[model samples]
Target: MTAPPAFPAPHPSPLDLGGRTALVTGAAGGIGRACALRLADAGAKVRAVDRDAGGLEALAEEAHGLAGAVEPHVLDLTDLDAAELAAVGTDVLVNNAGLQLVRPIEEFPPDAFHTVLTVMLEAPFRLIRGALPHMYGQGWGRIVNVSSVHGLRASAYKSAYVAAKHGLEGLSKTAALEGAPHGVTSNCVNPAYVRTPLVERQIADQARTHGIPEERVLSEVLLQDSAVKRLIEPEEVAEAVAYLCGPQASFVTGTSLVLDGGWTAH
Candidate 1:
């Protein structure tokens, strides 16, 4: 077999992914949507997968006229076998589908906890398992896990979310070690309070749980630990994902690219 062509100077800069195919879970909205669009902008054919069929349609509509195509794939990550099948043959994988239930340990439902781990942790493993053979065959691939600051630090009323993300971090690292020789890189992007439907939905829950008004949740709860004093944009996190999938990050593996705005500094 012939060797791959040499990457252009300033590799992955100018971030061209033309002819590549990327699969992004939870691609209906928020950071997932942003990542799908960003990858498509970089000329990658994107498989936008989500449980929300309408949202997927909207995402595909918005992706019109991009450098590459957006193919809508309606999938519920809870379906482990289907999730794995959805990932096959992709050159890039962004594991971003997640769910959150903010309640103290005692109040957290057992089923909810299981669902969190299944969607956030186990599904990623299966997706990676599904994507690996094709990636290994070509001797190149990228896996970017959308972890959270919770992955590294504990947070109140977030037992399930925290546990799942922490597990994802470990999974990402293990994949990195195994994928190294095959030219595949696995990494996590840790963000704090991204401005997405997930975070917006949490505001009211946080207010009620913390005995504060919804308006104050942003300052007193969400951004309190972040030195930047603001919510991060979905697009910003997507950019980091793109960078990881780029040629410049080939040597970057088994690590978390944190975009927490100093949340972990405390």
Candidate 2:
């Protein structure tokens, strides 16, 4: 076989998205909030979408003085049509909204499973469907799905979350293939357990599921498989999302940018 093409030299200028519009779901807080701010810092007009009106307000306030503005758009991704509509006229899309329930499959609530799948998997598809028109029209777009280690590897008590993320991984790749010719790229940022409100909320559920105290849950459960033995910061994962949207990643599509603290190394 012929040798692969040589990698190009790094660009000198920093990432600059002066007039682009970006929509980040779950922008109320955590990885999504960090992503909204990071993209705004790169001069992208960020539409921060989430169900938490107050949290979105706080995020908007925090993003003041950035290179670009953060416009809070209160949205519930489970509203599929609204989710798609909210993504209209956008350049970049970050699918990060999610819910988790730690319970055995036999004990899992069917409604909760459906909700997790809807928020984590189906909503991303709708958002992509909405964003594609504008992105295809402009001949450029970035779709970053904030997945997790659970997307790649399963855990005992997180059937719904694991299944949803795995499905997200597949959806991301499919988008990449279909959008490649249109100059749009789709990729997943698979981070390990992150230090966010979501994780904090899950601590109790995990504790109950694993029969461990809340205090021991972090070390014995969440970080057990991670070589780093610590939760990843939301900003760290956000930086990965920013990188995927930068010029450096124009050809980097249909891939998992795993930031799993070596959880998948095994």
Candidate 3:
């Protein structure tokens, strides 16, 4: 409801983050893991947060030789207070953690819907709140929300995911307006279907819901609307996040960078 006192300065290099601190949620796997690695590659001190301690450990191991370092912080985003606390002092924040459940509105479980919204929408809000002060003080920050095509367009049986992403898109734009005066840019990267463990796991759920074979879910359901006809890679989505964090995108804010492989074009 209230805004922070803000303006950030400038960095010359597009991908250099020599002394920056970045907090990436859902960093244990999927888009989160890729983003952590990408930010660290740019010399950021990355605080990788996720409930998966094992995955975070493996991520740390994989980031051993990067230009920056990955500090694994195991925390479930459902703990709103802790999620906010964990975001303190971050220069950049990537809100990418999410879960999906496929079912008709009549059949959808309320608990699952609540969990999805809490993690995807509520946690991001807390993280942003925690990070704003430091960003405002320093006069420069980037907030990248890894949204989805569903943020702009809806599909059947993905009510929770759609609602959460749409809410995130609005939140991102509002942050952009409020934080712009303080040298912070907020934006959403709307990727279509992505190749990740989460998406892979959803294949079966989707198949069951659609009464289709698991093998056909990808071609018939997920990619049906995408002109690209393929699932986006996690690294590709991370690159978009990196760009938004870079010098080139300093002027780019309050926007949804749609990378839906022409899905929206149609």
Candidate 4:
């Protein structure tokens, strides 16, 4: 109900999500942890969702004394119904939880594919579906999907992860188009390989698949196309997420904010 600080100043103002409710998935660590803290710093009540209860507890401790609070919700996204239920009444949604399985398509297990698609794609749809009603009633919402470079570029032995991300990109665009009329915005933040446990696990899987040592995964596989040649830190990705949820990115719907460090440029 109050006007945001006047912009066009020498330095842009920090985001202020005072009195808002934000839900961040995979909030136990990595980019999700960073995003949760960033939003809490902006004064949003952050519902931190992840299956790792201990990690969530640690996150709660770390978030102590922020402008907002962290409420942990331990649930695996595989439960589509519960995932939707957990999203009800949230003003902002950050769909960051995901999994990866590196193997040739022929070798990719059907169950793993289904699990990846369920968590990374279908659950997000459910959360968006549940959150939309409240958001539409309020006439404002922010939906940020944490996609990956695989969404735009394909690589061998990452069939499940790539497929899910590509689908998420499409879903985000569709949400943007539909939400625009109601003042809700949807966008995807596509980052290249990030230094998270997920990516670290991928390193070992990739080594096994490619028959190369784990040490070469970073230089040869992950950062091969990234001109920056470094694994993006989770905080960097979180900063981008914060920008999208801020007043400045209101007009930035139906777009993929590519933080791939020039991977797609090649």
Point to the candidate with the largest lDDT.
3
TM-score for predicted model 1 compared with the true structure: 0.94
Clash counts per candidate, in order, are: 0, 0, 4, 0
In angstroms, the error of model 3 at 191 is 0.5
Candidate 4 C-alpha error for residue 124, in Å: 0.2
* C-alpha RMSD of candidate 2: 7.5
Error (Å) of candidate 2 at residue 163 is 0.9
Judge candidate 1 at residue 33 and give its lDDT. 98
Candidate-wise lDDT, in order:
0.91, 0.89, 0.92, 0.90
Q: What's the distance in Å from true for residue 145, model 2?
A: 0.5
Quote each prediction's TM-score. Answer: 0.94, 0.94, 0.94, 0.95
For model 3, what is the C-alpha lDDT against the true structure? Answer: 0.92
- Tens-digit lDDT track for model 3 on 1-266? 01122113122234898899999999999999999999998999999999999999999999999999999999999999999999999999999999999999999999999999999999999999999999999899999999999999999999999999999999999999999999999999999988788987888889899998888888888889988766777888888999999988999999999989899998
Q: Candidate 2 clashing pairs?
A: none
lDDT of 3 at 70: 100
Clashing pairs in 4: none
Q: Each candidate: RMSD to true structure?
A: 8.0, 7.5, 8.0, 6.8
